[model samples]
Target: MTDLNTLLQSPIRWMSQATDPDMRHFLRDLQANILKGHGRHFTGNIFVSFEGMGAQAVARLLRDLSGYVTSALQQLCTARSSAGPGFDGGPVRCLLLGAGAYRALGNLATMPGDAAFQAGMRARQVALADPPAEEWGEGAWRPGNPAPDAMILLANSSFEAVTRDLEAAEGWLNGSGARVLGVERGRAQFRTFRPGGPAEGVEHFGYVDGRSQPLFLAEDLKREAAAYAEEPAPAGADTGFDPAFPPSQFILADPNARTELGAGSYFVFRKLEQRVRAFKRREEALAEALGLTGTKAARAGAMAVGRFEDGTPVVLSDNATEAAPPNNFSYANDPEGMRCPFQAHIRKTNPRGESTPKLPPEAPAERSHIMARRGIPFGDGVRDFEADAGQEPEGEVGLLFMAYMASIEGQFEFTQQVWANNPRFLRGLAPGEVPTGIDPVIGQGGDEAARTQLWPAGEGKPMVPFSFADFVRMQGGEYFFAPSRSFLREVGL
Candidate 1:
């Protein structure tokens, strides 16, 4: 068996040695897009369902599909050298199988024992506060509709590459007995800081995103630390924010795979539609309500988002114009939600070591819940920040939120139900204060009274109430397991 601890500590060095046959086998069996994100500019997600297919037929399908599945070792090798295969030297290809797919292959008994995965995402509709089946668009999770048996995730450096690969996969599936249920495409979007300057990653709401991710590999942790050291440090910034995590946080043993070293991760896929115009309008209206004018008016949105559009954390610096926003800050200094409000989208999603008071400064409880999010925006047109009232897309454009976790219920679902959707969260931290309120960005069902606290007058002043609205709506989603490459290759036999 591979020394998982040692391997995770220094993946590059471990792979360089290439002496440990067990470690090599482990990585070769494990699928890609779990340990590290693909970081591709364009992505194509193809959901396939098998109808009335027998175990023999499903096994045959898996055997054929295995040819396209990229292993973790392949991805790491490509990352190390640009002369590898696929477009732009590397195109990520992954296969995720749902509960129904496992059952169709007659392997349900030995699949990962996740109750949530077994029950499917549709079963958790009430708990997640997701819209009913009817509200979900076609090809999404709905009652009576065949649940997606398998999903083929293809990503590459360019839109043309992704489209070409997607078409090839679809053409093959047409005769493979599996039916292509739905297809979703994602492309990276960026916002230009200056007219001629390079663009930075931003979601539909114009907020810098994908920061504060948990680093699983030692090399990544070291790289992040080095990058942080090179940046200009702001005074009072907490340098103790450690992003390193153990390999067990994301990987689990594949019960039915051919190799003992086989490993996989639980994948959560959700299509979220952003009402950009409404959200932007609300931000401006909230600024007016808080009596904030001049440059400070931007804080209205920052109060709800926990960061300004430039990715500057409200806790670290109130000035959104501050260059190179640092992601190294924690909530240790602003425990009372005086700076970054407890209900802020970032705060709600990742508490950053402030969820529980009794837990030590490390806050392992909060950190344990962090998952590897590999999402991409799936829409067109640059957001018109100065557009008219009716302009900007209210729907048909949003995020293809994808994440990998060891436990669906513990990490992804817990963060949503217990933190984001729960208005009572962080209430224990501040006794006798107003409800922390739902996360304004992604919080689902809540009453009109659900409002976030904002202190425009600074600390010691009463908070202004900004009623929360559903700016991001759930279009559809499902849960699947990114199976081990060994499992996919040997399942038929």
Candidate 2:
């Protein structure tokens, strides 16, 4: 038997011909969008409910759909010829089964032992600080709302392609003993600041997204190392950030699979609506309150976001630069939250090296909480940094936040509850320090004081006080398990 942990420690080179059978089988059986994101420009999520369907009938439908599901190996092969770092396969499909689906299938006992997944997202509302289910958007998770049993993800390079694929899928699903509840569509937006440079991914809020990510494959690590080595290091640049992560961070055993190599990942999906106009207006107000004006006023938003709209980390540089942003740094150098405020969005969620008891960057306890984020912007809104005063979007625009993790309680929930929404996080780093405050961008359900941030002034000066308003609202979400290809194929048997 292959020691899965040992095999995963060494990154699997998918393209290598001499790769071991164990690694190759694992990749072939694992579903796509876990090890790497399905970076297609267009995506559609089809929520399905099998409330009235017979178990046998639903099983048949799933068994048939399994054949069309894409695997990690297949995605990599299709994207090998692409010039960029995304999958090129048109109309790629990934099917995720919710805990309710397992119950409907009469296999709830065999589902992965995750309490949060079993309890469902709506049941944990108070823990996550999410609004009541009734307040969420239409088709959101709520009791007596015909909970979603399955979600079919369709992705392609164009909106037309994704639409056509979704239509076809819905047509077949309608007659396959399943009912389609609702559909969520997403598209990738990019901004090209330079005339000829490649466009970088940006959210509706005009900030670059998906820059810092954990690398699982050996080839990806090598590629990143080569790129970092080729780029000349800036003055005082901390290149100590290690992006490598073991497969154990995401992969978990499939309890009901037919083979030992079969594995899957826990998936978390949330619809976050961004209040762009309010957030931008608040940024300007904050700048004015701090007595900053002109070009220096941009620091207000940068401090709140932990990075400028151009992707430059505010901790590293006070001003956004035209050059490519660097992610190879930690908070070890700036222990006093002087460079990047403790309440900054990125810093609050990912402390990098900062911790309550001051853990190192490579500590297993801290690193275990990291998950693979694969989110993309959903609504049509502003995608530029310098939009006019009235140009920012106020509603129906934000992130279709999606991520994969080994444990929902340990990773996604821990980051959201223990870090982002907590005001006293990182308090033990210094003595007699005030509450660090909740994350300004995504923190929710906090009091006015909890939402207040302590903005640093110059050295030896008292910190300025600024309270942030809620700018991001959670519309709806669910927990799912992306089963291994082998398990999906064999589940209905």
Candidate 3:
């Protein structure tokens, strides 16, 4: 027995030691230094909480946590680091806070000073004043807990500096009564894809991924009662608090939070091997069997997934050209799935409206899940290998798939179990069927239909609309939680 209870309490214990108003200043200096990082190999992430700590306290910790993070990052930039010839691809960017960082505000009752308490209480006001969209790329923001003490971010760093910073942070946090949590060297997978080639890495059937992320202020987020009541409820929800633990699908970190919620993000890294030859052979063979030619069959295949192979959405611009504005299109323009089959890979993964198990906007059942995709393609290193060649099982080559989410069961797991890995997703079809469970880019599930997502979607159609012979493969992975900066300062040494 691993004594899961004790394991769970470890991080909390480390955090209890660093509880002081002065510790806040130490964190501020740390933060300032981190914000100034310009290293190439070194990446940074931040998490600042007010949980057991307070606003003046959090303000204290936030001011310097960045410094330690930056120093840790610099230590990771050495020449011996991964990113070597065979290094796996994960997020290279360090995530910072949005409004979600407020979760660290801690238990309102446990904090001190009535005046400071009031300011700390106003985090929601601060949150409403600013949101993640205002910070991350376009509408992109960081989210999720993927490992403790932000260990995963040190994937390719030197141990000496990591040790130095580790000791310093440990010293401060140990003084508090808080505990530190860690999942050192947690591994993630990355899957990559080649145009008209084999599937490998993440996001196999290529439809602009990381787009189906949860909309915090969407009409649904506001309709719920519990969602609004728990902790830092989203803007639409009335939780008074803000969602900070998982931060966003993008990376965001905090200073002293143990259960930082949405305050920080993780760098997911996975190696997805694509079967290039397999996909091409399957596509070409399917095209010929259907008595279709270049453009016609290609169009139909594109229709199966809401987008073209070049990362363009077909629903908005059914054309196969890369010029499609898939990233900025409105769902109102085309919601019926006429151009893109309702079972397309992209559609299945992010079913904006076509969900079969419909629930009210306020329903708590299906709202917990929703993640941001921050993955990239990694394979064939240079040459765009033939998709058909990849199918032959020559080994290697594919997208390095990586995703970040607040709750694995809610976001990543749901996407895997109900959408990408489940065939009957849209309505009622074989598991892993096209459109519903089709994972075109870097496949991870093992069900038969998932192996050939196109099979079922094409079965009943009178004209046999689309077919996918290719398969996406999952290499390996695990789950983790990234803690808040305060948690780290108190316990992660």
Task: Please provide, for model 3 over 1-493, each residue's C-alpha lDDT reduced to its tens digit, 9 standing for 90 to 100.
Answer: 2222232222212122146433232222222112111222222122222335444454445444533343212323322255366553322223233232333444421221112212321222232121222221110012332212122233223334434444555466546432333212212222334355533322333334444333322222343334434423122211121222122332233333444231333323333456655665566665565565756566545655555555555655535553323243334444444456555666666665445347656654443455544444433333422343343433454554445553443455456556665546564554543344445543344445444543322334444433362355444322323334444344322
Worst 10 residues of 2 by lDDT: 231-240
- How do the predictions measure up, each by TM-score? 0.92, 0.94, 0.49
CA lDDT scores, all candidates in order: 0.80, 0.82, 0.38
Off by over 4 Å in 1: 3-14, 83-87, 107-109, 140-144, 194-198, 232-234, 237-239, 358-364, 381-390, 428-431, 451-456
lDDT of 1 by residue, 219-302 (tens): 677789898887665556554467777777787777777876778899999999898888988988988887778998888899
Backbone clashes in model 1, listed as residue pairs: none
How well is each residue in 1-493 modelled by candidate 2, as lDDT tens digits?
Answer: 5766666666667776236777678778888888888878888999999888877777788889999999888887777667565535665799998998888878523767899998889889999999988888875344457668889999889888988999999999988878888888898888886666678899877888887798888889999998778655545545356788888888888777667788888999999999989998899999888777999898889989999888888888888877777777777667788877888988888887567356655555877898899888897543555655567889888899999999999999999998899998866335777998889999988898888878886578789989985999998889999987887777767
Candidate 2 lDDT: 0.82
Candidate closer to the true structure by TM-score (higher is better), 2 or 3: 2
TM-score leaderboard ranking: 2, 1, 3
Task: Give me the candidate number with maximum TM-score.
Answer: 2
lDDT of 3 at 398: 51
